[model samples]
Target: MSASVERWLTLEGLSNVRDVGGLPLRGGGTTRGGVLLRSESLHFCTPGDVEHLVDVFGLKLVLDLRTRREIERDGPTAVARAGVETVALTFIPEDGRELPETDGVDPLVHIYLGYLRNRPDNVVAAVRRLAAVDAGPALVHCAAGKDRTGTLVALVLDAVGVERDAVVADYALSGEQIEAMFRRWTTASGEPMPADLTPHIPRAAAMAEVLATLDAEHGTDGAGGAAGWLLAHGLDEADLEHLRKRLTESS
Candidate 1:
């Protein structure tokens, strides 16, 4: 493992955030930390957070998944240092929903799982970017660190040969991490936790369901898993190697 991975591994900021690294793949590989990351919107990171990501982590690429309106609302990430590349990708909207409907991060995940079913193009476009450029330590994100981020991360995981079940587990962990974060404090009125503020279990469950659907359509075969996704996105043998070289593959 590298020092950069240590800097961002399992990072739990006040807002929803995490490093989607260190998970075991189906065969015998694990995603290296700092090579890839997933998180909620960067609209609210403080200066300290940005400094940590830039100075300590050395992020070379950022895949922002928010809508144009969302970016206007949140403002751009303040990472102006050299050597960091920011790529904006707007996921194709299907099922008539713009993004996650409920504030619940998990339910919003449902939107993405379904979104990828008919619109593999969105996923492919992302892969195409990976093929065209070398964005090391890519961080993909949307609002609340779920939905668009999860869908893209799931595809990335699949592309990297991670088992479908393992991908779902990683997706579910986001809910647990965020839910636990919300439960830490309370209001003076002692009011029951607002549904909006609490973690969204339904959203997580829906995300799981979507993954199951993908399995039903496609199995554990590497062709339909990571390799298929690459081929679908028009990646050649060299492109696949380029991606594999970027993933963490050690103890």
Candidate 2:
């Protein structure tokens, strides 16, 4: 991994917390630092961790992609108590709720595609919220910061012309953190890992396939591309431009 891309923060109570910056853009420049971050749940963050995020990292917005039930069950996050604005934009509708059975696909892939098919508006809204953040950095996250978070981050990076491979690479990085995350969960909950959740491991090839599908659905580059697809769905042009400026460095 490139040094520029390995900017993980060592927080007292968080894991997989890293800045999504310094990624090489398609043309030449790298992503700007301290604007966008992706992480696992902040529900367990201590006061010091909150200080690091607010004072040191300048995190002003917490975009929680976990479902309503997850938030209620987990209670308040450190960010919320620290006065950082936290927005709940669940990527999966009726998440944790009982649903009709559907077969013929990898369950993980099915859930991933469900984010796009079931509630694309939420996805667009999440990006819009990130783009609208003006006070400081925005941290987006889900329960484990892998699937839902990865999908949204991929789209945001794609919208700004970050190389598709680089986006997939970033997504793949989440796989490196899964074992640690599982340990944390098991320790916290005092329960063995559930059989159903075991198969949801992150894979680079899965993300690669997603990007390929995205490119097939929308043009891979230029104005009428992935970003355009977001615009068509709900994201504003100005907001997209703001995100591009916030995340990308000048060449």
In lDDT terms, which candidate is top? 2
Which ranges of candidate 1 are over 4 A from the true structure? 1-14, 80-83, 92-110, 117-119, 130-133, 179-193, 196-199, 202-205, 218-226
Which pairs of residues collide in model 2? none
lDDT of 1 by residue, 1-251 (tens): 75233434443343456676777776787876766667776654567777667777777677777666777765667753344677777675523455535565555545665456546665666765654445655667776566677777776676676766667766666665465444532342365665784445425566566655555555454333546544645667776666665664854
- Count of clashes in candidate 1: 4
Per-residue lDDT over 1-251 for candidate 2, one digit per residue giving the tens place of the 0 to 100 score = 85634688888888788898888888889888889889999977989999899999988889999988899998989689889999999987774554346576556656676788788988988888878747478999999999999989988898888987888888878777777888788888998966554465688877777666666677643532568668878888799888888889867
Clashes counted in candidate 2 amount to 0
Clashing pairs in 1: 40-145, 106-203, 106-204, 107-203
Model 1: residue 203 alpha-carbon error in angstroms: 5.1
Give me the runs in candidate 2 sitting further than 4 Å from their true place.
1-5, 95-106, 133-135, 193-198, 220-225
Scored by TM-score, the top model is: 2
